[model samples]
Every structure is written in C-alpha cells, then in structure tokens.
Target: MIDTADEFESACRILAAASGPVAVDVERASGFRYSARAYLVQVSRRDAGVFLFDPPAIGDMQALQRAIGDEEWVFHAASQDLPSLRELDLVPPRIFDTELSARLLGWPKVGLGAVVERTLGIVLKKEHSAADWSTRPMPQSWLEYAALDVEHLLDVRDLIADELAETGKLEWALEEFADELVRLPKPAPAEPWRKLNGLNKIRGRRNLAIARAFWLSRDALARELDAAPGRLVPDRSLVAAVVAQPRSKGELSSLKEFTGRQSRTQIDRWWQAFVDGRATEDLPAERVPSDALPPVRAWSGRRPEADERIKAAKPAVEAHAEFLSIPTENLLTPDHLRRVAWQPPEPLTEDAIGEALASHGARPWQIAQTAPIIRSAFVHAAQASDDTDESAS
Candidate 1:
C-alpha cells in the first residue's frame, strides 16, 4: 500500500509518465459503513503497472490528481465510484464508463466480471467484492482482488470502444459519458424514514411519527459511530418496535422483534425517542402531494388518452431502440416517456417533443431518434381515443 508521503509521490510520478487513459476503481464499504468513503483506491496504467493506495492513510490527493487529473479515467461503473473519488479531490476531466458502453451496445450482461469475460475471455473471481474494505492492513488476497478490478479494465474499454466505433455509436457513448461526468447529486428526500420496511403494517399518524422517530434516532447513532444503520438495527426491528409500542426500556428489550447488536445496549435512547414521538404533535400525513406521475396501470382508467399515448409510444420507442441495436432505457429513460405522456406541451410538433425530451434529461442522440416516434404515436393515440368515444356514443 502507498501509505507514506514518499511512496505516494513515487506512485504519482510513475502514473504521470504512464501512457494512455488511467484505469481507476474505488473500493467502498457500502453496507458496512455509514459514510460512502473511498476505503481503498486502485489505479492502473500502461507501463506503470497498478498502484493501490490507502485513502484514509493518505493526507491529500492533490499531488496524485495533478499526476493524472487531466487524463480520461476508465471505470466499469463510474457513477458508483465517482462520488467517493470526488471526496478526495481526485476529479477526472473525462471518463469512459465501460458498463454504460456495454449497455449502449445492448449487451445482455454489464457487470465488470461479465464484461471482462465476454470481451477479454477472462473470468474474475468476485468472492471478495462484498468484503469489508475499510479494514486496516487489508488481507493480501483482498489487495489482489482490488488490483484485479482495474487490471483488465483498460483492455475492456478498448475492445468496447472499437465495437462502438464500428456500430456508429461512439458519439452517443461520449455524450452519455459527458453528461454523467457533470450529473448533479440528487436532493435528499424530505421524509426518508417514510420508506421504512413494513411501514404499511403500521397505521395512523401517531404510529407513523413513532416509526419516523425511531428511524431518526437510529440514523443519528449510526452516523456518529460511522456504522451502517442497518448493521446497528435492521429496518424490520425498528418497525416492529413501533408496532409493539413498548412503554419502557425493559419492555423494549423484552420484545424479541426489537433486537439488534445495539438495540439492547441503547435501550434508554430508543425509549426516550419513542416517548418523544408519542408526545409530539408533529405527525406526518397519510399521503403526500408530489409531482410524481401515477402508475401506468392506473392511467388506463384515470386518464384513458394518456394511457394510449404511453402504450403506443413506449413500444414504438422500444422497437426503435431494437432497430438501433441499443437498450430501450439507454436510448431514453422510461420516466421521461411517462412524464411526456402524462402531460405533453401545447403545439405538440416534432420540435416540441424534442424539447420536452431534452428537458427531461435526454441527450441529443436520444431526442433526435425518439422525438418523431413519440410525436407520431401521441397523434395516433389522440385519434384512437376519439374513435373509441364516438363508437361508445
């Protein structure tokens, strides 16, 4: 591991002189840690070999960033690693996401191992993928596993690039990568605790408040200790406690359903949170208003015309994606299709549909191909609705 300042700088210097795009991957303790931090960062470059760095042991990453910052970085699933990499100021100027490339190419399997096996004919041992990455002095086998992540990534990127170029979709991949590079972080939901497991089993605003309180208390404790909330107290246990409505710490501990590594030890804390939730008047509503669209199944009865629009347009867009030899979601997101179907703009010309598609985060290549299909399908949907109404009358 490149822990000392001199060893780190030496690795950076080697990477600086290495030719071609830098292949990079980050190992994070996703389920085991509260914070999504880069426990270990792996980078491989041609001629320079691969370097493994202990992110926590390193003081700053600016030196390493300068070494290869301007070069295009390659990753199998870039988005999953980019956030943690950014936390260390190791930003990339451009990226080549092999997973996204495979998706655009309409490959059946896009996982790193699958892509590697399919593209390079090498199978990667993935037993250590879910291992705790934050362990100090990581096991030798684990280090090798981390190193393997980026070992053949650049080769996969090259092979995929050639195939994409041959298919006339290289530009599409670049545009997709650019958009992903600048994608903004999603805003945190207002009522995150509302998504608790078995939440529907608990009814009434008071009970909901208790659930929310328990979730919030658990979240605070988890964050403070840097432990995954689920590790400390599983969602099922938290929800069960609310349903049981334990009045005291002893009662809470006595319930078998209310159990976890920390549940019994932190009984007083949980009890207090429950008491506060019971006394507080700030109860959550049963249903919240949102801009989210109704399910497509419900649209058939609630909005017949809109239902026809999605039914006709969705399959049409999907068929076009097939014609282009690309995945439907890769061509355009389903949410965007649903949004346009639910509420199309005035003067729904091809240009208007294209604009709508762009507004919903569709790339130019996607809008160019799908806008006409959507406009024509919408026109047919309206005409079909009119015909049905006339026959009924």
Candidate 2:
C-alpha cells in the first residue's frame, strides 16, 4: 500500500515510464460514510503492473495525474468512480469505459465480473463489494480484491474495442466515452424528502410536513456524524414516527424501531423536529414545478396531442435500436424522445426534427438515425388527423 509522498512519487515515476493506456478503479465507503471520498485508488499499466494507493493517507495525487498525462484511462463503470476521482484533483483527459462499450455493443450482462468471464474466461470474486473501505490499516485481503479489479481491465478493454471496431461502432463508443467525461454526478434532488420510500402512505399535508422535518433532521445528524442518512435513521422508522405523530419524546421513543439505543438517545431531537414541522409556515405543496413536465401517465388527459405524438414516435426508435443491436436508451434517452415528441418543431420536416433533437443534446449519429424515423411518424400522425377532420366535415 503506497501511502507516503515518497512512495507516491516512486509510483508516479513507474507509471510515467510505462507504455499504453492506464487502467483505473476506486473503492468508496458509500454506505459507511457521509462524503463520497475515495478510500483507495488502484491503478495498472501494462508495464508498471498494479499499484494500490491510499488516497486519504498520501493526500496528493497531482504527481500521479502528471504521470498519467494524456494516456487513456480505462474503467469498468466510469461514471461511478469519476466523481470521487475528481475530488483528488484527478481527471482523465481521455477515457475508455468498458461498461459503456458493452452496453453499446448490446451485451446482455455488463457487470465487470460477467463481462470478464464472458470475454476472457476469468471469474472475479465479489465478497468484499459491501465492505467498509474507510477502515484504518486496510486488510490485505481487501487490498488484493481492489488490485484484481484493475488487473484484467486493460485486457478486457482491448477485446471489447476490437469487437466495437468490427461492428463499425468504435466511433460511437468513443463519442459516448467523451460524453461520459463531462457527465458530472447528478445533482442532489429537489424535495429529497418526497423521495423517501413509502412516504406516499402518510396522509395529509401536515403529516407530510412532519416526514419532511424528520428527513431534514436525520440528514443534518448524518452529516454531522459522517454517517449514511439511512444508517442514522431508517426511512421506514422516520415515516412511522411522523404518521403516528407522537405528542411527546417519550411517546415517540416507545416505537419498536426507536427503542434501539441509537434512536432512544435522539428522542428529544426527533420530538422537536415533529413540533417544528407543525409550527412552520408555508409548507411545500406536491404540485409540479413550473418548468417541469407532468408525469407521462397523466399526459393522455393533460396533453392528448403530446401523448399521441409520443405513441407514434416510440415504434420508430425501437425499430432503429433493434436494427442496430443497442439498447434503445443508449440510442436516445426516453426523456429526450418525449420532449421532442411533445413539442415537435414547426413545419415538421426531417431537418426541423433533427434540429430539435440536436438542441436537446442528442449526438449527431443519434439525430441522423432518429430524425427520419420521427419525421415519418409525425407526418403520418398529421395525415391521420387531417383524414379524421375531413370525414367529420
């Protein structure tokens, strides 16, 4: 385990002198910690071999980044690790995501272990996936598991790249990889309390407000303790306490989930949260945001023409995706499809539809393939509307 500045410097020299793209992987203590910091970073190169460095210990990766200058960094699921990597001032200039490539090539299973076994006849162990990587004096066994993650990643990348090239989808994969580089982790959701599981079961705005209070309280406590929000106060227990609306700290502590030592200790805090919730003015309503689209399920009554447009447009997308043997989602996001279909361009022609898709961030390849199909669907729908009107007249 390289921890000191000297060791990291040595590792950098080894990496800088190595040939070919570097393979990278990171282990994060997701369920065990509040922050998404990388506990361990593992890197491999064909000549430099595998090196596991403790990011928290060395506290400097600038030297490491310099070592890896313009070489492509290969990762299994690049998005999952990229954000944590960015925290250490490490960002890949060029990246090749094997998982994204597999999805583009229409692989049925894209998990690292599954893809490795299918492509290279090797099985990866999976026991330590849930282990707390933030523990001090990292165990040797866990270190070995982390090392194995990047050991064969370069080989796997080579094989997958060849297959992508054979099918003339290499450029497509590159485009997706480039897009992934700019893809930041999704923003913290708005009204995060509304996302609590089984919150819908709580009746009335008052009780909903109570649930929100509990959620905010729990989130603050979790952040203070550097613990996962769920670990601090399970969602189910929070919802139960709010729904029951226990009048006092003692009454709230009587619940089974709250009887645990951890929960019992925080009874006053929980009770205060409930009281504050009821006393607060201007509670949030469950209405959609002004700029947001309504749920697709309600579109039939809310916007019947949009519903008709989407229904007409979907088959075209599915047919094209099937012909190309890629996931329909990779071809074009369903949300983007819905957006274009709902408000199709004026004088709907192939060029106009293409412009709409491009505006919504569709790649050129995607627009080139999907625009013609969507235009045909729109034109056909318009003709059907004209025929219906003529018959009524």
Candidate 3:
C-alpha cells in the first residue's frame, strides 16, 4: 500500500537495511487485463518486513532496484514473473527459483501454497490466487493473502536448499536456477492470429483474411482500452462473424453468435474489419513455414534409422534417469534426443553427440549424462542392421 513517493522512499530504506536474499512475488491480472503488467509486487527480507507495491501508483522502481538490486531474489516460478517484473525495472542480480529447485529435487508438489504447507505446516487460503488484482480500494483480505505469499518463502527456501544438498542435487538446482534467470523471452509468433481457437474450423483464404482482420482490430481496441481482448469480443464470436459472412453492420450486429459486451455497441468497427478483410489484396496463407520436427512417435515410418536409434537409446536413457532418481525429461529433453537421432552429426562420438545436444540448448550436466548413451545407441543400431543384412545375404 506504499503509493506515495515519501512512503516508497521509506520502504526502500527499510529494504536496504534488511538482511539476506529478497523473496519476491508479483500479482498480475492475466485474464482481466490486456497486458501482463504487475498490479502488485510483494517483497520480503529477513530483518525487514513484507512490502506490497502498486506498480501503477509507483511509476519509477529504480529506487527499489537500488535497494535490493545486488541481492539474490527468490521466486516460486521465476520465469512466469520475470516478464512482469522486468517491465517495472525490477530485474534481479541472481534468482533462486523454488519451483525449479523442487523439480530438480523431485518434489511431488511445487506450488507455493503446497510448498509452504508441506515444509512449514502453514495452510494458506488460495481463493484469491486468480482474483483481478487491477481492482481499486484493495480488499483487506487480499492484502493479507498477498503478504502471506512471501511470509514463509525464505524459510521454505532454506529447507529446500538443505534437502537438495542431501540428495546431491544442490549444484544441479543452482545451475537450473541460474539458467532460469537468463532465459530470453520467447519471440512473438509470426501469425499470432492463427492461434485463435477453432481457427482451423474456418476454411478458405478469404475467410482467413477476415479472421486476421478481426484479430488485428480486436488487438488494437484492447491495447487502447487496456482491457483483455476476450473481454471485448471472444474468439468464438469472431469465428462466428467470419462464418456468417454478414452482409452489413446491421447483419453483423444481428448475428446471434457474435455476442460480447462491445459486439453490437462497436458494430461499425466490426463491420469495417469484415469489409477490409473481404476486399484487401493480402489474404492470409493457409500454412506458415516451420523448422519444427515431426513428433517423436512419427519417426518410425518417417526415418527407420532414427526410430532404431531412439528405440535403442531412449529406454537406456530412461533407465539411467530412474537410477539417478530424476525424471527422464529432466535428464535430457525427449525432443532434443529425437532431433539428434534424426540427423546426428557425422563422426558421432560422445563428444559429437554432446555438441549437437549443446546446440539444441541442453545444459552441460545433461549433455554429460546422455551423450555416451546416445553414441552407444547409434553404434549399436548400425551394427545390428549390418548383422541382419549379412544373415540375409
């Protein structure tokens, strides 16, 4: 609730004086707002207390940055919060992601509420987890809930750290956490409109263009009003409008399926999108180019050699993972293994396989474990093929 400049300064000073890594959490109005902007940011330190910050009220967060910028920050799922946190200039020097830590340590439940209750025996009411944080005159109950998020975080972190050390996964967890800190934001998809639900259900290039127009128009309006696009017009309504082929704004407004709070009220806008979509020279293509490989299950009929390599290697790799007491996917991502098997680099030694895995963003620890297994699998598959051919001849 520290909104004023004076209160912010006081809060920063208090945080600066506090000891240990800062526990941080962000509350974003994901479904209710247009942007993933942080409605509230909560920070906790050892000696100091929990502080709830209103980002819209406090425009400049560099002061908070200066206060705790040098200290390591702790978050449950740091990746999910980093984008919103960066928007406020609240980047951390280092971060310990409890979620990643739990994953590495093979903990069954990694959610903040579960982690706290499991480790510290505190049952937090999670009713407000999905509440619209953009609401004004913050409820007292919400404030208490927000405070509790960071309340036992540091304690839980300490407990988890000990468990990680006991299981010989502390270094692995640290490596994962460090990687999580520097994870680049995924690039925005080229034709984000193509992601709309039931988009494929509508066919023809003209219809595709109409859908594109609808998405763009809706996006612009949503950005302007700072409201979630779905709130103005849901995806189903847009698809319906395109399918109906409304003759005029009147027809568009009258379409029963084209229903939203602003659907009829903004009839002119919706109608224009349809008109432009029909007349424009830029019709959307049916399919976009992709570099993604076929699913692993399809490798058998597509590439028998790759199928052989994966079949020989995957079970062995999985067995090792079980021996190590880690998830198979965590040890080496299934896709990374499949890609390497499909098109393995020539001179496929352990080192060569390791390099190929590295090119696909595998961590050093993962490459170290799986490269030998992969090399052996490929060689074994090749030798088995030679033996079968010899027997036939």
TM-score of each prediction? 0.97, 0.95, 0.95
Q: lDDT tens digits, residues 1-393, model 1?
A: 788899999999999998899999999998999999999999999999999998899879899899998899999889999999999998999999999999999998999999999999999999899999999879999999999999999999999999999999999999999999999888888999988888989999999888899999999999999999999989999889988988677889899988788988998888988998899999999888888888899998999889999999999999999999889989999999999999897899999988998998999999988999999999999998898899999
- Candidate 2 residue pairs in clash (backbone atoms < 3 Å): none
Best by lDDT: 1
* Candidate 2 lDDT tens digits, 12-110: 999999999999999999988989999999999998999999999999789999999679999999999999999999999989999999999999999
Worst 10 residues of 2 by lDDT: 255-264
Which of the two candidates, 1 or 2, achieves a greater lDDT against the reference?
1
User: Worst ten-residue run, lDDT, model 1?
Assistant: 242-251
Better of 1 and 3 by TM-score: 1
Q: Rate the local accuracy (lDDT) of all candidates.
A: 0.92, 0.88, 0.90
When 1 and 2 are scored with TM-score, the better candidate is 1
RMSD of each: 1.2, 1.8, 1.6
Rank by lDDT (best first): 1, 3, 2
